[model samples]
Structures are given as structure tokens and as C-alpha cells.
Target: MSVMVAVPDSAEGALALTSAIAEARLLGTDVLAVNLGLRPISPEHLMSGETRITILERTHHESHAEVVLHALAEHPETERLVIGVKRRSKVGKALIGSVSQTLLLEADVPILAVKLPH
Candidate 1:
């Protein structure tokens, strides 16, 4: 089995993703950490090899979900997906939208979400 993790350009998101990757390893699932940074292929900040990391450029300003879906469309070989979501209180949740929420709702494969520690 395999999993895709959406990693944004933030340290907290990265840490959460690393935790999710560790969990995937324990679960025997291959990890694919997708870094949709400001530009494509900016794999410089992250370590190499321990996890399968792929950095992609944003295809559209409003089409991030579609970009992710298209990227993983060929993952018939994978089993699941993972993403990181920053924890938020009721008021916070009311303000900021969540990518993890959208992915969980739309992805054809099962989605797993890791949140920033409270």
C-alpha cells in the first residue's frame, strides 16, 4: 500500500507530514510527500530518499485540489493518501478553510490527516 501526503510551505505542516510518514511506515504503506511550494521541484529544503518526495508547481491559483488529484491519478499502484491540517478552535475553523478537508471530501482513495499538536 502507498499514501500521498500534501505538504504546504510551512514548518508546522512539514513536521505534521513527517509524523504522518512515520505512521505510514509503521503501517507498511509507501509514503509520497507532495510539496506544492511556490515553484516546482524545490526539493532543496527537505531530506532525500527516506521518503518519496515530489514538489510540483501550482497549476492554477484556484485549482490546487485538481492539481493534486491529477498528480495522483496514476497511483493505481498506491493504497491511500495523507495530508496535514493545522489544528484550529471553533473560531479559527470558522475563519480559515482547510485543504485537508477538501481532500478528505474529494479524493477517490482513502485520506488520512495529521494535525498540528494542540
Candidate 2:
């Protein structure tokens, strides 16, 4: 089993990545990181001797939520999905759908939602 995380180019994403790595270490499993950012994640910065991390690139055609869900479906060994979330107004969420919300509702696997410290 492995831990999966959706990593975007934001502070929340960074926290989620760090949290996923820590959780994987505890679970004694590897990490499957789905990169949702426009730019690729730096493997050298994320890699550690204790845990193995594999970064999956996002296709141009796929939505952020789709990419994450697809990765989970592809990797049946994924024990958990880690995602970073921030507060959003109801109006904002209504106007712009939330990826985290979609994952929370649709993902078949367990989800670990992390947030930045105020």
C-alpha cells in the first residue's frame, strides 16, 4: 500500500506533500504524488532516503480533479489520498468548483485533508 497526494503550486500543496511524506514514513509505504501544478515538482527537493516518492505528471487535457482521481484509480495500492485545503466562501465555491471538495465526495479511497496553520 502507498500514500497518494495531489500537489499544486501553492503553500497548501507544499504542506500536503510534507504531510504525505510523513504519513508514508509512518505507514512504511511509498508515496505516489500527482502533480497538479503547471510546472513539475522538483524531485530532488522532495526525495528522502527513508521514503520513495514518485511524481506523476498531469496531462494538458485532464482537469486537476480528474488527474488525481485517475491516479488513484490507476494505483490500486494507494491506501490514502492527501490533499491541502483552504477556506472558501460558499459563493466562491459555487462560482468555481473545488477540486478538494470533488475529491472528498468522489474518491473511493480514504482522504487526508491538510490545511495551513493560521
Candidate 3:
């Protein structure tokens, strides 16, 4: 079993990556960290030894949500998906579509939405 993690460029993304690593360690599964932007992941963020982390960088012009959904489809071994979700109000959500919300609705496997600590 594998866990696919979407690592965006935000505090919530950091939390999601860290949490995904921990979950992978506990489950003895590998982590596929998909970076969907131009910014590369810092060295500190790549500190997982128990489970191997395969980083897939996609700097294309596609939307982050689309990239994540594509990765989910590409990786059939992924049993669960981990992503960061910010608390958005109803109006905020309606105004701006959230990637996490989209994945939650569209993903075929189980999804874990991690949020930043208060």
C-alpha cells in the first residue's frame, strides 16, 4: 500500500507532508510526495528514512488540483491520499474552489486532509 501526498507551498502543506511521512512510517508504506509548483521542497522536508519518499515535480501550467488528480490516477498502488486543507468559509469556498475539497469528492481511494495547527 502507498500514500500519495500533495505538498503545496504553505504551512498547511508542510503539516500535510510531515503527517503523511508519519503515517507512512506507521503503516510501513512508501510515500509519493507530489510537488505541484515551481518551488522545490526544502531539504528539511525530505527527512524520512523509514519509508522511501519519491518526489515527483511537475512545473507544468496545469492547475494544482488537476496535477494532484492526475497523480492519483497514475499511481494505482496508492491506497490513501494526504493533502492540506485550510478552513474556508462557505462564501470563500463558493468563491474559490478548494483542491482538497475537489480531491475529497473525486478521489477513488481514502483521503486524509491535514490542517495547520491553530
User: Which prediction has the highest lDDT against the true structure?
Assistant: 2
Regions more than 4 Å wrong, model 3: none
Residue 110: error of model 3 in Å?
Answer: 0.3
Instruction: Provide the overall lDDT of each model, using Cα atoms, as 2-decimal numbers.
Output: 0.65, 0.91, 0.87
lDDT of 2 by residue, 1-118 (tens): 9999999999899889999999999999999989999888866549667899998888757888999999988899999999999888888988988899999999999999999987
Ranking by lDDT: 2, 3, 1
- Candidate 1 regions exceeding 4 Å error are 27-29, 39-62
Cα lDDT tens digits, model 3, 1-118, are 8989999889888888999999898888999999975689878998887679999898567778889888888899998899999987889988988788788999899988888767
- Find the number of clashing residue pairs for candidate 3: 0
The whole-model C-alpha lDDT of candidate 3 against the native structure comes to: 0.87
For candidate 1, write residues 36-91 as lDDT tens digits.
66744334545534655544445666555666776678566556776766767999
At residue 88, give the lDDT of candidate 1. Answer: 77
TM-score of each: 0.69, 0.91, 0.93
lDDT of 1 at 36: 65
